[model samples]
Target chain A: MLIKRPDDIKPSDITDEKIYHQRRAFLQAGSRAALAVAAGAVVPGLMFPGEAAAQVAALQFKKNARFSTDEEINSLKDITRYNNFYEFGTDKKDPAKYAHTLKTDPWNVRVEGEVEKPADYQLEDLIRESQLEERIYRMRCVEAWSMVIPWVGIPLSALIKRFKPTSKARYVEFTTLYDPAQMPGQKRGVLNWPYVEGLRMDEAMHPLTLLAVGLYGKVLPNQNGAPMRLVVPWKYGFKNIKSIVKIRFTETMPNTTWNLSGPQEYGFYANVNPEVDHPRWSQSRERRIGEFFKRKTKMFNGYEEQVASLYSGMDLRHSY
Target chain B: MMMYRMKPALIKPLVFIACLFPLVFGIWAGFTDQLGANPIEEITHRTGDWALRLLLITLAVTPLRRMLGWGWLLRVRRMLGLFAFFYACLHLLTYFVLDQFFDWDEILKDIIKRPYITIGFSAFVLLVPLAVTSTNAMMRRLGKRWGQLHQLVYVVAVFGILHYLWLVKADYLLPLIHAAILLALLLVRAWYQRQALSTRRTAPQTS
Candidate 1:
């Protein structure tokens, strides 16, 4: 009963067989319960090395055109962690642990704030309208850890284009689902609830920026942003808000949690640039998760060519 | 045990051998690579664990004798204290050798700069005089000074706990438990000593 053959199953399909087998093996060994429990207990870490690439393929992103490439999708899924970012009664692992309590089936997205076509879109309606594309990108966490993931979702620009941003809109702000009764983390002041993240106009329109729905070639894990989330590579991990329910086009800079915590420490642009180091440690060096001792991190996490141009003349130290 | 024998020589060997057990087990574990992946972490943890255990054992001797009617336990206190110093030395060695690769510049910088390492190193430095004066000959030569020197173990114990507490990420339950046990043992010794002094003062004349 746990295993169901997909209606669209075909041998020619490039869905990661390794991931399917890995999940099956994990289930067959009766490790699903333990893995699920442990996943909620530990700080969600980097994916197990080469498995990131395989896991990204399984997200079924290619069928969805919103994703730019499998590599982009791979980077998003591989970075993993469906954590909703409220480090309260639940820790980093709490989302996967407590998120099962959430009801994502009847989800909806409210498109407002300087949009020509302001509307409340049901989750099912959006899925039907937009084609999913898997994009793989390097995801860098603020805590000096990093992961590559393949995420299946439509580009935010593509979705936003449908709504048509007004000429006055120069920035995009996203809000996470906020209900104290539903999201237990909101009951306490773990972080200023209704977490907000923003992007500049150019960054928002970038082809790589995604509003993700699923990862690992499957429906988004509850611990991960189940209904919908943002994937903004080159930015610090927190910039990619998860379980988004609202999007607002704004003219001013938004107040983000980390930015509010220490404005000097976290700037408006939390891009993943090795040249910009946190005061505590150098960002130039990073330890690859599974490799532990072998692999060393590279500049812009090996995507320098794609994103470095965005910060052409600015001083990294000031922005860092 | 020491009471029935009425000989200092008898308990010394047993205590010495018991003190050596942690070293032997730790060495075997390290050599066989039983320390697990990140052998460095395992070695550091194991040595630090043994050091704390021995410190607790050393502190336990007096209270254990008073509460359990096993006065002989006090005879092994010096040996256990010395063994704690031994393990603390090994713990530092593992960090310096495998971890820092004896990079003097980095090692010196860590000792001077890192608060956790400083506490750990200071505790080790305080332990040196106690270990050096642990022998019966040194005890006889120093006499009153020996007792004063050995009391440094108390400072070492506090520093050891702080070293562990500062290094932990969160959920300091284990270090807190160790601190509680040390507190309980220290309180027991103080209470028992007060009772002994009072009893001696209140006793009737032999005449």
Candidate 2:
């Protein structure tokens, strides 16, 4: 039951921060090399392809924008290919096949509820002001699977502050896009259409909470909740609602999709607690996407230091 | 008569080889990466599925013999039952080695806490006694007790169906289909039993 401190995590356990920053460079060079081979063309001028690629991949962020973790980031292919965005379908492969129909260019997120400056903002205009940072986080799903992802986004606190929430805003609710034509899974009621998720006001404002716009140095793929999504590292992946179209701050506890579907299995506070077993399956261990054997699931998904104080007095087993 | 004409040595080996088809195909699929993105899940599901299928097929042998008047069918009943046990072992091994990684404490908790695992574990446990007594020497040693003990297969089938029913999140179509097949097999046995009972009762009156 011993909890390892983030500092105690070995350097080798985490993907090097340099590798994460240079992911774009690696990808660009890889694709370029493939293209060059296909075209029977070689670099005429460039002597060091790696150096040139690094320069191309260097992205500028705010001075204070960086959240590094000691967990290895999952491959981009695995992240995009193996997703649980049930809006497209229930099967793992369904999203990649069906999410192509989604139109993300003309996207707008409507900000509403207990806020002074409640208004709709275009996806581009909204994110133009906030600084983007690359955060490596451990994403644990309720289905006993875990992944480490490098998310590129601004903190939710920055965006929430812009809206200027009233004192009555005790909680924040996020709503996903609900078009059946676009999201074919909506036709079948796998869950009540337009998946919803929420967080407490403190949790929402927590620096760890991210309003992700991109991942792995690219705009979020349609399968990975295109345009925008929430990334709450300490909680189950389902809490990170995708394709967010509406953001509402409320006083009451919001009805989340999974919690509504199976209250016993999923709770409002879906914190990644290994001790609190799901009614159907054991949560004590999780299979890291590419690994053969399961590793012990750390409480709060190894972010207990950052988020444990948020639920100081509440019993996680019951609340979960 | 055609089955009677065939030699036990020839047909038994053929049936044994045929029974191994599922395992062979499963291994081939695993090697070829045809088991898809989640290979472990695929193996677990396929092995469990084949185990249940073989158990049902074994249950069908007696009814087939009664309907078709093929006494020779009884010769392969033990083989079919053994194959069911074989697949069940593979199914259990997949869960233990691949899924659970020999985490006995977690597995024990699952067996005690989860209804699906409890039923599935019970089914596998019940099959063990029947499998142990499956040998010719043990069958002779046990005598009349052998038939009574092997009646556990009927209960095993029920647990197996319940196990499958509880495991699925939604889309009950596959489980319902399996349930329907099991029901048909059980109903046929009941009808035949009823016919035999009535005949026994009326035979003294007629005589």
Candidate 3:
């Protein structure tokens, strides 16, 4: 088990290798001063040298929270954009190709509509204000592919809380970056431009909902949304909007691209419950590419304990 | 007439070069990993597209030979027809071996369940007889019946176009272009055959 109840090793135990070597040498010297301190000394927490560099170099966000542990950092790296984000391009591989041109710098997210503090926030400011946590998530793409990834990002709840949504704001609407001058795909209208996706406010604020910044222990590649993206792990890949530019707290449900294209096929919730099948294909089994054969998809991608209750009263068939 | 006989051999090198070009490109692309994540799909699509195009060229020969009064086209028809089969085989191999991993069960299901696969498989199966009988020895053995047997290429061509048209989710423009070319070539053949029949009827009076 890579993670064993978190207490097996403390950060101070793994501090600068040079200092630890000196401490070890002093202990070996059998000096009275070293021995006196060594007897009741508190273990100094050690951080990877790279983490120190990252902490200093990392652009200031809402709060100065570093990744809690290295394990969390590694997990964040694996998930972000392994699946296709096709509003950017047609091919499954296209997102990585076409999204490279996306400018994530100077990102100002418009948090407007029914929120009490309806204001635009710079991405850097938004990050500086919140706590970033690492969440290990099982991501399932609608195309029947799955991956386990660790994502580093502030929780969606942290970002949403700043806006202070009014009681009338029943749903939250998210819009992707859309500029035909920069994004050529938007010119052809393969899908509705300014690709919109939505979630109920409670679902939006779920602890599992992540506003991801980096993957694989590094800042996201431009194709993977360089600065920030939404990661709704239990839902299909498309529900995880990339390079978001707008987030509106709305009273009515927002029209999503997939839902608008074919309302009968794509429902708003778009949860990854195998019980609900896509119009063209069955979602019962998914092929994790690295795995040889079919692996049964878990209900809500194994976050049933956290998310299953949200859909309890509603008929999944209707919501599907 | 003596000089014209020497000119025909010049076409052999041209024919050989044309035949080798696609194979060279396909091989080079495969070796260099230029086919991206799904090389087999790229190879399959390229070979399939070439096969359909060559099949169109093969069909065009008869109408061209009749209209231009150039009977020399009959000499190259076998070579072009074989090239179409060559690419078609490669197309099918890519799909069956690379794409399906030779899983006979899945392939059988695809053939039965998918209409595009059914059309394509039928076209390839029809091509086998045409390819087998393309030789001069078989042509001599079959005699006049050879023409009737080779008529199967027309049906194969139609199915080939239909196979392509059915597989696409959108952007029907490419298949529609193929269909238009095929219809025009078939119409020209029908017109040429009618002209030949009328010419045969008037031959005695001219003599």
Q: How many Å off is the CA of A287 in candidate 1?
A: 1.9
Fnat, one value per model: 0.00, 0.33, 0.00
Compose the digit string of candidate 3's lDDT tens values, residues A22-138.
112222223432432333321111111212222112211222123222222212223333436555566545655566556665677889998899888877677741244445566
Instruction: Return the top candidate by TM-score.
Output: 2
TM-score of 1: 0.60
Error of 3 at A85 (Å): 4.8
CAPRI quality of model 3? incorrect
lDDT of 2 by residue, A294-314 (tens): 999999998898789888899
Error of 2 at A279 (Å): 3.2
Question: How closely does chain A match the true chain A in each prediction, as TM-score?
Answer: 0.74, 0.82, 0.75
lDDT of 2 by residue, B146-173 (tens): 9889889999999999999998764466
lDDT of 1 by residue, A1-320 (tens): 11112222232332433322222112222333334334432211111112222122222225432223343232332244333356323344456456655556567789888889889987656653125556666676665555567666776666766777777777788888888776777777646777788887667766567787766555566556766788887687789888788888877777876677568667778887676666433465443333233234456556567567666797867865
> Per-prediction DockQ scores?
0.06, 0.33, 0.15
Candidate 2 or 1, higher DockQ: 2
Best by DockQ: 2
Off by over 4 Å in 2: A1-65, A101-105, A117-121, A128-130, B1-18, B33-38, B60-77, B135-145, B168-173, B199-207
